[model samples]
Target chain A: MGNADSLLQAEGLSRDYEHYNAVQDYQLTLKRGEILGLLGPNGAGKSTTLRMLSGTLAPSRGAISIKGIDLLQQPRRAKQSLGYLPDQPPLYFDLTVEEYLGYCGRLRGIRKADVEPAIQRVIKTCSLEEVQKRLISHLSLGYQQRVGIAQAIIHEPDLVILDEPTKGLDPIQINAIRDLIRNLAEQHAVILSTHILSEVEAVCNRVQIINQGQIVHESQLGIQEPDKVFFQLHLARPPETAQIEALQGVESVIAQDKGRYLISVENAQAGLQIVTSAIIQNNWGLLGLCPQHESLEQTFMQKVFQEDRP
Target chain B: MIGLITRFEYRRLFLSPLAWTLIAGLQFILALLFLVFLENFITELQPRLALIDDAPGATDTVITPMLIWAGILWLAVIPLLTMRSFSEERLYQRQALLMSSPISISEIVMGKYLGLLLFLATALSPTLLTAVSLSTGTQLDWGKLIAGFMGLYLMLASFSAAGLFLSTLSRQPAMAAALSYGLLALLFVFYITGKTQGSESVLFIYLSHFGHFLNLSSGLVYSSDILYFLLFSTGFIILTIQRLDSDRRNG
Candidate 1:
């Protein structure tokens, strides 16, 4: 969705804590306007990775570059194009929304003359106009989260890193923040860590699931994998497992209910005719037949709990 | 970037009532001490004038005591004011906001130090009023008063720098404040040890800050004394910067 030049490129990023490696050999390349979802379980080093990317925590080894500028060597120059929000919104409780945003803009090297206009732009974009004059301590959790995002974008950074952007919020607030994040991606490349699978599906263009400090899976959205598709069938008289297993392109069969079974197919379109024909010819009295696409939950569980795999 | 951080910190200091309360409460105590010293000076003035050709004037007797009271007040007040400088941000997990910005750690430390210095300057301004008001009726030694205030400023700057360094060491604001006060007290009491250990021990005399401040408070503006304060405060500020830089590597 962007040009050939990626906005963020991190290679071989790793952090060691004397006893174990928190994050190991991490790699990422994000283009402009791409929403990359970082999916991981607890103790998966997601926050540690984000912290290293943001320059808050130094990596034990490896290198990160933002817009082709080395993060470690030219941090000040590289940070100009980066904005990061940690897991908790870092707000100065005594300052109002406008005051805090203004401070953030100038701290990021925004010109004094341009700070006000930039703050106004983010206030409008984050829908924080009403609470612009209210102290952050007085605002609700949702508005505080909005203010957090507003500070990140106040400098108009090209790469925005958010660690658990929607960690705590009601359903409506989460939806609002999700929409705001999607809107942010129109101008900035966003990388957010979240536990909400639905949120990733709704807003992310690409997802990378990490387990045990490694990227276990990565895929782009809207492209279905037919090879992994399976079918669920209910019948009055089900056939033997060996009979279904003998059919061409069928991987396995498992009995589910009194007369139901889940059939794993190598290819959904090609295996459909063979499995249905066998069931009908056997007089199994097929009552229901439907494709069951694998959900991200299954993929996440499989990736996290598979002990033998790295 | 340093200026931006300084302004933000100043705003925070302005909003917190703790700063105002400390300043106001100290001013009240100094004023009360001023009256007591003035009454004692007035009662013994005539006897001293009759006995000696040049008696100690109001600046020597009254202003000096008031300045000493100001010093004592600051020994306690500076720590209270600077307790939340870097420690509070760390405690609240907001250090990332400043550390991750383009601004360097030295700039952050300088900005915080300057912000607290400005607040201390303003908070202690009223104590100078007590010294200046003596000009209306009695002779005031302007040079001595200036030197005394200069000493107070230097002492307060060193205290603030030390407090700032201690703040960087701990995440709890109260612990920072207590440690700073305890350290300052330890330094203050070294004067007694310096006397007992004799004049040959340069380390005890120099480390305490007692002799240097005394020289300045007595209107003796020796370059050596000024240099001592300058280097002392700079040492603490440098220590603070070093600690903050290490956090980047350690975190």
Candidate 2:
């Protein structure tokens, strides 16, 4: 009841299964029109938290509220506000895409008058027009994913929680899902939990990294640079061993086999000019100079290992 | 809201070849068993009545409306109809979708149990038609026969609910079916053994499923039997709801 304004809120949520803590001391908030990316490795409790928020699960010790409706008490009301896409899509293989969406819409409490339009909107929005009449079992993995998203939005819920929505998708399918999610954010809040860090950057506005049942770090997209960069120097000839060490703020330079050196630097600007100029002045033919910002993968590793240290 | 959801569930179940085969096959097998029982009952009745001399005026009240075979056939079919009610959903991950929906636990549990019960009753219609056809052969105690049918309905309803409660406890369909079979076997064997020894030997016989089947089998309309079966069905349904709720909360 205290969290009526937020689209979804888990305050001090925790769940234990057979005496083992699945998710401990977890807190997340999804406001309207926002997409929150929950990132974590396998067994890190990403799915557990998503289950709790979706009302498929209830926390052992916490409050999950949707627009101020307490899920533990008024579950039906809270559930009406949530649309969840689990890692495995809960689709009936025998039903066609259109029939599946129609069933889902009704289950979510959509009025009879709106069932048709709701299904149509999601079909078009998810680009499921081609396979709308095909049986779910016959569709490819990518199209199945689209059907999952379509069902999640059929009732136009306030919060759409997609867990591994792009899992097992090809590059083209991944692009389609990314676009679909971006479009979904316009009408409802979205939270997509994934181990693929790049997915968060592409579609989500904010991200939280969880490890071993707890959130370790959270950052908003485009808020700040990733704080470190790598300069991959392609040289016609290997530079002097001390040359990389002499540069300001250069952490280390390791030979990456066959005349390439992975030069780690404190930031992008400091290493960019220094490495390029150093190559030219030293008469080392510079085949290429590439900058590597902290990709989501690296940040994931950084957080995971940092938390592991005693 | 629950009806609409359950109707959709029925449509889905109808499309599954596994579901169709079971429902259709049960009907086919029951028809065969009914014919065999009718022939055997008539044959045995003739010999037993011969000892009464030439008095054809004797009332065949007990032997005409033979429903023991019909009742036995129903016991075998109802549990199969309901054994996968919740187990298959969990196996395929569809239960998660249902649990997360804007429906109460009671609605979901009752909807599934009724859905299976409806399918089972549809299969029983032919058997009822056969009973009507047999009425031409002799005078039937129609009032008692109807009472027996009512008892069969409630008895199957109770068995189906017990199966459904077991289904919700496990994700494996075979395990769920085995569990219901195990419980049924205990009631059939132990109840008979105890009744033969002494009624007081096993007071638990009062709760045995077959004990409830007896009132209907013998064409005796006892309000206590009706109330017992109704309570049995309702009690297990409540158990199923709580089990699902626990699964949801524990996750």
Candidate 3:
């Protein structure tokens, strides 16, 4: 069931080839104004999941509702509310950028009278004004990719599904595309798949890390609150590990070479006060104290490698 | 939706030089054939026409053979024209644009098919015009000419449909073209084999598209021939739609 703001709802989604399952029981609920990033390794079914959600690939078993319209039962209506950009930009190299966008507008059921305005709107949005008259094949990879995005958003659909929108771009181009994607998400619910962790961190509001055809972890970006805090403690004279672990609120203390200790604590403020006061009371010098933040890369690696272990 | 796709496909075809080159080459060859047929009709057949009552006129002596040559030429040309209909899209992974759109599979297939037909018609226009130009100098058998044109068009439609279906079966455009050429040639073989066995080999003759096409080209308008082309084209078009639908499912 989808709520009013829910733009996409997929449940029990799975796809399989004859010999192996590609995606298994994938589920997602995307709300308006949210950028949901699908992060996975190569061959991890990120594209397959995006394809199924976009109505381009039928799931062997699943249900998908785009804007509350059943994709399987009423695909025409459901697909009208969403636009998709596959891994490769579905561009016809023979057509000029403007002509291709017009064709895409018409294909998306935009009225003949409104097609020009729609083309202008996406061309402007995608920053394709200068090359609008040039053939797509003549443009660089970045512009061709922008044209791909232009087609996807031409009809101003409520949802946009893109598979690896920033796959083969340079850093500057990737940033530009990310900005364009951010602009799109302001009015459309965006779901993009990528193997780049920083891409998810930079542009997505939430992320799902998939591995071996299953979602291993899902979390809201920038809001993950770990139960324990970690700190790298450097000291002129470090206390024994048992003495530090005996302190209240200090979870674990592992000694390192040259008087450094990796410390985990139950609470940041209280645990820091307790540990520092104990060190001062014991005459152990505190050379430096720094908090270590856990990055998404760590989580990704942990989830993916953890799943691969027998 | 179908109209939009058809227009796009048709324009896309013209944007490429392949279609233009094919059209020009076909016209040039047909023009040479037309001149040869006309020269024979004038220098060899015209003098004898007065002695034979109701002998075949320029329509049979010139236009019929010219149209027959055009038909055979198109048997090769149609595959080249229709080979990229679906195969190139799949090869480039551009079918996602249509597959993800709100349009149905049948609409996509029909739109591409009709677009190829539109191109075929354009390619055949000069030949048709040359045939029609004969009316200015001689009394043309309009009935036979019309029947021949209709038969050629029907045969081409069948060829294009089969070509389009084969295009869906493979991502390689060349492979699709070769497969379509082979399939059409097999039907021609059926006609040849059936002819050697005489009309008594009703099954092969009936199954051969060339036999039915020949009937129409000879100014015979049998419903059976019309039904055959219709069934052949429709069957292939439906198979194309089903193939695309299965691709979505199986992908």
Candidate 4:
């Protein structure tokens, strides 16, 4: 996964359904060894964006490439390198688990001889060994989703796109699928679109949030760089005292209580050094100095709400 | 690959017990009607039959095969067989998996068409025994029997393509089925209207399904009739592929 990068890229892709702009100028890029999550509320054009990237739907404007193959111009070649799991799993309910996956493998252009081994690998990966022969319609939604995922990757496609893979699953099933997505990222570039922010937090390496047909926010895992700094200080009462106020990078300090203060600082680490060192040297009790960073969930909500229209 | 797809489709659609039952049921009903009509012909015209003993009637040559139990069954049951081809897929939303796969649209359409072709051939098989029985026992016109089957197969296959085209347009199987029947009924009316008026009705000629059916069923194979059904099948299939493309783009 680390050896190769940027398996799928969609640049300025847009779609218009009749008079409505379902997705407009949606630029999304997916790199190998990364699980990019497409996050948006319902009717925010998530499905449209996914369909266009997968070439299951064409964009009215812009182009997409799978491994540098032009999707709109050479769809068959581009689609050969891709796999898409639609919101509806597209399971042929009448076919058994193995039969459906085998058919999908063949459809995805896997050689006839390699199909059996491919099916076996997907079955094991998706934990469908027990239900391999069972009819898909009889399976629970969780198993059905697993089957859906199994079919999507049976051909060992370089880029796998899943739309709401865990929508109807229970928590246990959701956890299992999250683990499955993480496992898939070990080999393939996985792009999943969901409204579940926690899903992005759990499995994805990066996330691109689409709101009303455009990208509103993009973030990485681990919240490495927060857009805003939050400060939590524990100290002995230090007012606008020289030890605190005379810090070189001090912006402002609001003393919450005798022992606690909410300090606004220009640089978080700089603020931490001065405030903690000053409290210690001045013989004021140095309890704690914590700079709060935004969680992905908070960042997601703020970006979405900030751009939200009345 | 096409052969494998055709075989898989054959099993999926043609091997069903319900499919066999539909074919056998239609076969028996048509053969029974033929038996009744033949018995009446044998009973009422016994004396006249002696006069034309060495001469075959034009009605036997033209109308018997043209309007036979086999011919009507071929045309009538086609809608049921083909209405679910694409409509069922659309309703189930399984078409994404089918169309999104690396297979070309031509292969998919042709594979399913061949599968339906096999099913239609199966439906026409039981009546072949009836043909053999009459040919051996009553000295029936073997040429006409063969021609009728060939014509009916080609004619009905063209109609089935139209049914499949309508199926691709709508998700509701019932609506697809009704719309197919509605178009078939209109074609029949055009032929009837042409018969009502003495001269050729150009609109009726253009629309008449029987016009194509008659040209071949009478043991006379005209290239025009062959071209008409061939063009009809190819045109509808192309339309079906385009509709699928439109759907994927909009979806």
Which candidate achieves the best TM-score against the true structure?
3
DockQ per candidate, 2 decimals? 0.61, 0.55, 0.74, 0.51
lDDT of each: 0.85, 0.79, 0.90, 0.78
Instruction: Report the lDDT tens digits of candidate 2 across residue range B127-224.
Output: 67766676677666676567666777788888888999999878888888888888788768767776785455455667676676666656667778
Sorting all predicted structures by TM-score, with the top scorer first, yields: 3, 1, 4, 2
Higher DockQ: candidate 2 or 4? 2
Q: Which stretches of candidate 1 lie over 4 Å from their true place?
A: A1-4, A223-291, A308-310, B197-202
Clash number for candidate 1: 0
Query: What tens-digit string does per-residue lDDT give for candidate 3 at A1-310?
Result: 7778889999999999999999999999999889999999999999999989988899999899998899999989998998999999998888899998999898988999999999998888887889999999899998998898888889999999988888667898789889988988898899999998889999999999999899999988865566799999998987678988899999998899999999999998899999999889998898989988777899999999976889
Candidate 3 chain B has its poorest 10 consecutive residues by lDDT at: B195-204
Tens digit of per-residue lDDT, candidate 2, span A1-310: 4554577878899888886898899987778878899999899999998988888887888888888888888888888988888888888889999999998898899988999999998898888999999999999988888888788888888889999999878999899889878887887899999987778988888999999888888878865665677778778887775876787778888888777888888777866777777778888888877876556777888899877999
lDDT of 1: 0.85
Q: Which stretches of candidate 2 lie over 4 Å from their true place?
A: A1-5, A223-293, B36-66, B135-138, B198-202
Could you give candidate 1's per-residue lDDT for residues B1-251 as a string of tens digits? 77777777777897988878887888998999888888878787755765887777888888887887788777877787788888988886688888778888889998998888787778778888888998997878999999999998898888788999999889999999999989987887777677773454667778887788877888889998888888878999999999887787777
**True interface contacts reproduced, per candidate:** 0.63, 0.73, 0.81, 0.56
Query: Per-residue lDDT for B77 in model 4?
Result: 72
Model 2: lDDT of residue B87: 87
Candidates, ranked, DockQ: 3, 1, 2, 4
Location of the lowest summed lDDT over 10 successive residues in candidate 2 chain A: A1-10
Query: Model 3, A243: alpha-carbon shift in Å?
Result: 13
Error at B138, model 3, angstroms? 1.4
Model 4 docking category: medium
Per-model TM-score, in order, reads: 0.89, 0.84, 0.92, 0.88
